[model samples]
Target: MIELVLPARRKDLGGFEVGRVLPAVLKRAVGPFVFFDHMGPADLPAGIPRTVDVRPHPHIGLATVTYLLDGEIVHRDSVGSEQPIRPGEVNWMTAGRGITHSERFEKARAQGDHVDGLQAWVALPEADEEAEPGFVHVDAAQLPAFGEPGVHGRLIAGSALGLTTPVPVASPLFYLHLELADGARFALPAEHADRAVFVARGEVEVDGQRVAAGHMAVLATGRATDLVAHGAVTVMALGGEPLGPRFLEWNFVSSRRERIEQAKADWRAGRMKLPDLDHDEFIPLPGDPPPPPNPMS
Candidate 1:
């Protein structure tokens, strides 16, 4: 029922902190999730600019989904999409062929807010790797919800425990967010070929394995795994059919390493278009130019 536990590597993204869990040296990806980052349980000081955080950057051959637990973010993309995502909502952006975007904390900059959430990159199938890039934003009310007694959850994408979200995904996958009251129990659905559980808050015991916050546990298949919450907890459970092997570097993911190299040159030569709304400042390729100033966050 349990395979291995991967702890998040804490990193300070200038102003706040980010916990990078996936693309691990131990496991590069779980199912279609090639990259995963726990973005700050850290506070953002008032007026924290977007440049201090993540500037406009490009991605290809993947979809980026950001689900926040607190605060809000303004997402601007090359597809002419400008949306603000609040806690409980999801912003799914597909960089099929190529796309660039920027995340700015507008409300937080004007009025301080907390930034806490999980962001994951889903690898596009080799067939759809060159499809047209797109973006979608689903409100919390649009996602499917389920619960009984102390267990309450929302299905972010794909199917889970008899419920499914309308969120459009390029592949078979299930991303769930569960909030369990202390003493409550949960059973991870075994509907997918690969499954993983991430403890975002509190603690839990899964089949005698104690999984604490800031850690992601890879679960074995074959049957549902039972877990009990020691306290009120937030659990993110996700998995799906694997997309075979993928090459990931910086912010690009592809099936062939040459594709990655080509993406590098494309970005270096300014072949990729910036977000229509955020075109002034972009994060240059590593070593291309000096970095931005670290503002208070």
Candidate 2:
């Protein structure tokens, strides 16, 4: 009975905003993806002060994958990687032990541009959780695309639909972006142990239940399901074998709370590293106590 649907909660981040659709009340993760954020569909008008200026921030024990549907964002990381990601391109940053980074809209596009995208945080496997911070940029043309005439799929990461993306990953998982014409149908792959669908725009029906835009349908395991588009729609499919339980605290995610604590101390003591370009503007930790107990625990 794959009927569980979790609605996204809107989050406002000043110049831009996003809808967080994952880690629902009963579910914390789908496969290795612990955090899923749907960014924008918002249009910043010209001549206004609307802008995006995310200051340098630190993260640990996970990889962040940013895929844009519209607009652009410039990514700068402690590893000295500076890349501007546009529509269909992907920015993958792994914060193993710890890393600092920032995201901001390009000056040219900040003046009246439509911004829309999805950002997913995939937790590293236990062995690779503390490896080394790294970054990779995969251009739009590099990803594989397939499916029927009206329905198209881009294998953004991992292997799916008889194709594998160039995006480097330390674990087995699938992150797919799908575009469906009216009445198009897509059958879910069954090789993965966990599966979920997030409808970004338009309407869709998965296994006979309507999934409106801004909602995520966490499918049941061990059975196949078909997704039919009620109209032109965009949806993201995610799944993989489950990693063990993981803990999350603000920007940090790890299997052990002690590791998160250590990361916090390192940031507070200025021991955490950041890129020289933006290091001077790193965000200071909030004065609140450590994050509350893990809701998924």
Q: Report the Cα lDDT for residue 180, model 2.
A: 98
Clashing pairs in 2: none
Runs of candidate 1 with Cα error greater than 4 angstroms are 291-297
Q: After superposition, how far is residue 36 of candidate 1 from its true place, in Å?
A: 0.7
- State each candidate's clash count: 1, 0
- TM-score for predicted model 1 compared with the true structure: 0.96
* Residue 153 CA displacement from its true place in model 2, Å: 1.0
lDDT of 2 by residue, 1-297 (tens): 375788899988875778998777778999999999999898756553413567788999999999999887789999999998999998999999889998866643446667789999999999999989999999989999887877988989998777899888989999999999999998987878888999999999999999999999999888888999999999999989889899998899999999999988898888988777675566667784543333321
TM-score for all models, in order of appearance? 0.96, 0.93
Worst 10 contiguous positions by lDDT, candidate 1: 288-297
Model 1: per-residue Cα lDDT over 1-297, one tens digit each: 889999999998777788999989989889999999999897777877665557789999999999999888889999999899898999999999999998888888888888899899999999999989999999999998889999999999888788878788989999999999999998886889999999999999988889999999998987898889999999999899999999998999999999999999999888999988666667878778754544432
Specify the highest-TM-score model's number.
Answer: 1
Score residue 140 of candidate 1 by CA lDDT.
Answer: 98
